[model samples]
Target: MVSLPEELQAREAAARQRMEELQAEAAELAVRLERARADLSRWEITRETVVQVLAELSAAEAVPEVVARDASDPKDAPAPHGIGVMAVPPWREGLVAGVLPDVYRDIVEIVADAPGPLQAKQIVPRIRLEATTAKIEGTRGKLKRLVERGWLDEDTPGRFTLARHYGDTGRVNSR
Candidate 1:
């Protein structure tokens, strides 16, 4: 008993209402997404803090043991007059390699093999990459990051050497 125009108008009004409902649902979803992003950011910060604390604790624990062992064993002590006669074993190359990106590993390899500290320019050719300025700069950045992470030492300005703990010999210290 409904007229045609009335039926069409009713359908149009229902569609409009449905559209409004969908818009509300979308707004709610947007708010949830924002909350999830904030939560993820918070979790990332917490994880970083936990990791740092654990590392510091582990290092602190290691020092006392090393010191005690060295004090008990005369052979373990450093040579007289501040000289270190024993070649301290290098850190595990595989361990270092596993954490590094390919470019960074390559840079480490190049530096480790060098007879002396190398400048960024000197390292580029040994890596066998196209010697573009960008590549050189990127290599420099990786070197700086490695130094920051204690993987390498800046022996002189703009030149780098492997840290004492990462000696070229690839031998792991028995201690």
Candidate 2:
């Protein structure tokens, strides 16, 4: 029994109230999103700090063994304690070949044998692949994945070295 004008006025008021509620909800969501982003940033920094600390601790612990090994003549130095005649630890002899796919294994082998950090292009020839643009790019992708998997280290941008744990001394076997 309300007049048309009154009904229209009521509808307009409801629409305005709904708009205000939506605006408040949007503001709340924005605030929550910002807080979540800040929390993520804090966690990322904490993770990086922890990783750096652990790397430093590992390096510090390895110093004495490296020094001792280096001081002794190659002929006179005692063989590593638990690693018998195997050049690599029995568990790690097939580590790359066992854990990784064929292409990744090839990449690790190439990096491991290199005298210094290698770029993707330098790895391509050793892998026996044509130096095409796509192949080189794919090699780069595989190298990055190896870095993520802790099998390689990016010594600098576009240059990779085998991760320190896999060094010549077989340090990882001691662990």
Candidate 3:
């Protein structure tokens, strides 16, 4: 007959072995998650750029040929408005969230609605993105860009909040 202590020891050893295996698997998954995140970030940026370019071209096409010829200097051309065309403009008096690109506007709305400053990881799930390292990093980049543009304030590293001067509820003509 087997001793109880002996059986217990064997069970403990088995459990430990299983734990070690799971830990190894977890580490491998972490590596894969990182790679996937990088790819996702690249694709997201590329898609946004392409969308913006197409919108610009479409807007330019809509202009009357005479108007197009009149604005020989691109500087004199009216800036494209709506959808992907406008990058986050610097926040100013009377500026509104509607002016931002869709993703940026969503980020701002999320931050504005939050009770306090939030990290990119916290905001990622709110934006309906999977809470992955790549998503967090991509969100962090957008938050930083908003800060640079004066649309958001990063009071602490990695934590974002709406700029004080930016009105979370104000109405402005979206362009």
Candidate 4:
């Protein structure tokens, strides 16, 4: 379908003949694809220094009472050497169960351990914290916020009930 000038047409036919003659000299590059991939794969850094740095970084993610609202109870609180905020209460067993961070785990423990509803004032002294966790007001906010999040039931104006058992508050499963 493609047309050319008569002189160009003859030149094109000659070019095709040359291409066919040279075909045996040129090899397909399909095998180079995997070789290039293998070369790229070799650039990966598996050095111990890089791995050690990453390990230290992962260790650094510890939860504090103020920032992470982490819910780590004293019992499960890991040694403070690592990055990840202490052991955040591993997200509880069921679906409605929250993914409590290390700080919240402590709050959950404190709330659940108490005999009954506890006021923020009452809970202030009970929380076991070191210099790393800052002060009481931050912890109070964590507790109150947990109540609002349905992790605990607030009784009076400021008292809280541990909602670890009766989760999802009063919502009934109609099924």
Candidate 5:
């Protein structure tokens, strides 16, 4: 065996110390990572619990309904950030597609100029859709969306009446 010099022995000791320090640092990092993982799991459970409780409260239909805000709440309370759910309302796509072929805003204006209810059948021919136009499934679906969104309501199911905002008298008879 080759003999180690005094300097070589000192170097070996220093290398061993460095290896131990590195191993200790690596161990500490692993422990911290595990803790972070546990904390993340805990936070996920917390989110799930909050969602469940909110959904149940909304479903129960209590008087002071605790509805979940579709947007972010303040870091503190009482601040509103966003609007409506990410889930599209069931009627929205069909409504958009139905109105896509027609000049919808113009039609709203046209009907607004009229005093009485506009029947679904009555508004059909008023829509101007060329054969090449993208989507013209029927105006019925779009009309239904307007009703659902509270822009219009049906005096009868087939016949839709406009909201007070339609004509701009600026006064809704609250009765």
Candidate 6:
């Protein structure tokens, strides 16, 4: 029993109020979504850090045993093939590629063959690994390890080359 124009105005007011409520709810949800994304980013970083630390721990624990066994019986020592337990010994004056695990040796050999320093992405294809983000990052880690162990040098950041150049006579020359 209201006038038609008055009823239309009342309905419009209600619709506008409902729209404001929905807008407020949407704003709140957007804030929550942003917070969740931040939390997910932190958790992803934490997981990656934990996995790297655990791998280092496992490598550290296994090193002494590999050393002892290799020292006791050189020939009887397990063939260094996989990356898991096959430790990369620190480079020495007389040490050769034979000392490294197969994967590491492949890296060293590839670097040695290259005309100049190479990036992890460049090395990935030579090593027969897919040129994916994960593969490149993993190779970068191995390249860093080689740098740390004195097997490779990082003269410029993110580029790797051999620490010592191998001569035609199979002798190592300081680079």
User: Which candidate comes out best when scored by TM-score?
Assistant: 3
Question: Model 3, 130-150: lDDT tens per residue?
Answer: 786767887899899999998
Arranged by TM-score, best first: 3, 6, 2, 1, 4, 5
Span of 10 residues, lowest total lDDT, candidate 4: 166-175
What lDDT tens digits, residue by residue, belong to model 4 across residues 98-165? 34544465566677677788876666566553212223455667776777665677767677877655
lDDT of 6 by residue, 54-90 (tens): 6655655655553355457767655453334436778
The worst-scoring run of ten residues by lDDT in candidate 6 lies at 166-175
lDDT of 5 by residue, 78-102 (tens): 2222223211123221233122212
How many residue pairs in model 3 have overlapping backbones?
A: 0
How far residue 45's Cα lies from its native spot in candidate 4, in Å, is 39
Clashing pairs in 6: none
Writing each residue's lDDT as its tens digit, candidate 2 over 1-175 gives: 9999999999999999999999999999999998897677567557755764555454444434322455457764544532222212122343543334445667777777777899999998888866766568868987887787667789799999877653445232211
- Candidate 6 — what's its lDDT? 0.76
Relative to the true structure, how large is the alpha-carbon lDDT of every model?
A: 0.66, 0.66, 0.76, 0.55, 0.52, 0.76
Off by over 4 Å in 6: 1-86, 165-175
RMSD of each: 12.4, 13.2, 6.5, 19.2, 21.2, 9.0
TM-score: which is higher, 3 or 6?
3
TM-score of 5: 0.34
The candidate with the higher lDDT, 1 or 5, is 1
lDDT at position 91, candidate 6: 83
The Cα error of candidate 4 at residue 59, in Å, is 10
